[model samples]
Target: MTIEPLLKYMSNYIDLTSDEVVFLESKITVRKYLKGQYIVQQGDICKFSCFVLSGCTKTFYMDGEGQEHILMFSIEDWWTSDMGSFITQTPADFNIQCLENSELVMFSYDIIEDLYREIPKLERFFRQIIEKAFVASQKRIVRNFSLSAKDQYLYFRDQYPLIEQRIPQYMIASYLGITKEFLSKIKSQLILEQ
Candidate 1:
């Protein structure tokens, strides 16, 4: 399926002409992954930057005690990748896994680099994407620090209502920095109050 969201995302930053869209479409490859599969594993040099078409994926890393602490989640219309690795051509510290069956439009780093070199407009697009991503990441960190577990859960649920339906409960808990049992308790408490 064509990624209409990609066009929309590009449009938000820079207007793409019909000819530019056609050229961009030619460089993008649609990829699919099954649930529990990794889109990119830790230590592999990232080759592509992916835009999620459907489903949920997480970026996380195992900590000293081997807990999988989440960095971010990508749902429909969001992009997923270890962008640092993708750009630097180095081993990724984060593992990106599909939480459910997912479709993505992937742009090869090399090809896109070529595109940016030849068509400078693509650089502006990427720069804008990265700038926004940095801001969002900063906000997430601030929220995680300030919000209580229940508040965080509530906020995340409201922010990505579709994400809850698409991803497993345990993964959601992991993303929220809580145990599955804690999440269950929170849900039960919420129900009781309601």
Candidate 2:
């Protein structure tokens, strides 16, 4: 099993002994999802927190009108899950889907709690991760309210330049909370300025 990516991620927060690494490897289940596959669907209980080893995934919600609003994107080395659902063991409000064929390391909530008990450092590591995620989410909310559409597009472009080539423009537009046509106009203006 290829667990190098997960191990590398954990190393940032805590130093794991070989035995701990082995224990982690035994607990995690590696899975692959094809592009367009749904890892967690709206209204279904989210059972696992997943780390993306490769490829991309998007967490999004569909409105009653059937429009998608992307909440977050996860690429290699990133973690993605419906946190509330995973923690509370309730149905998810959003869907997590793969944008490309993806490899993921998944830990069930029970296993994760057990790990936290067995290795307290892992709890701190996850707590730090959640803290960062919360901060980022807050920043995004602020940006959506305060930033201009062009500024939002530019911010996203600067932060995730490679994402444009990986996913469709409409998805990017949705993520930016702008119309696809408006995003195209922004892109055109940017090109003209360049």
Candidate 3:
């Protein structure tokens, strides 16, 4: 994986000095997880923010029936964490798991906070990322409520095309708020029409 993309992405928000970049990079721990491995589990406080360098992860919440509803997918360059737990230092209500063998640049809460203080530009960069994420979540929620399941799946694939190829159909169905059976039927129908 190229650090160039990540550095460029960060540059879009804030200018980083060489020393600051080096310092931030020094604090990051490169880690890997196998598919189906839990990155953050329910009841565990999220102490770190994981930045995906490659592979996919799913954030999901389990229901009383033991069914999981996927809230989001994190792919290359995306950040994954149980936000509530990270921000509040409380037990997580959701789980984040690797959908594929993955590598990430992980930063602990303390490290991030320390880096932010040392590099004021980093704080600005994080604020920008957070704002963008918030807006995207708002738009996603609106689409989920207003769009049909098939439409939602289609749009999600269109938006995150790489995610479609990397993640499982069942998990994609969960993210779309539809049953696996229903999603399979829809896929079959679409293929037949094509």
Taken over the whole model, the C-alpha lDDT of each candidate is 0.87, 0.94, 0.86
Order of models, best TM-score first: 2, 3, 1
The residue pairs in collision within model 3 are: none
Candidate 1, residue 59: lDDT: 95
Ranking by lDDT: 2, 1, 3
Worst 10 residues of 3 by lDDT: 1-10
Q: Count the backbone clashes (under 3 Å) in each candidate.
A: 0, 0, 0
Over the stretch 1-194, how does candidate 3's per-residue lDDT look in tens digits? 34665787787778888888888778778888999899899889988888888888999999889999999999888999898898788999999999899988877888888988899888888778888888999999999889998889789878999888887789888889888899999899889989
TM-score of 1: 0.91
Which RMSD does model 1 reach against the true structure?
1.7
Using lDDT as the measure, the top candidate is 2
Residue-wise C-alpha lDDT for candidate 1, range 64-134, written one tens digit per residue = 79889788889888989999999899999899999889999998988898779766898998888889999
Q: Which residue segments of model 1 deviate by more than 4 Å?
A: none
Residue pairs whose backbone atoms clash in candidate 1: none
TM-score, every prediction:
0.91, 0.98, 0.93
Quote the positional error of residue 112 for candidate 1 in Å. Answer: 1.7
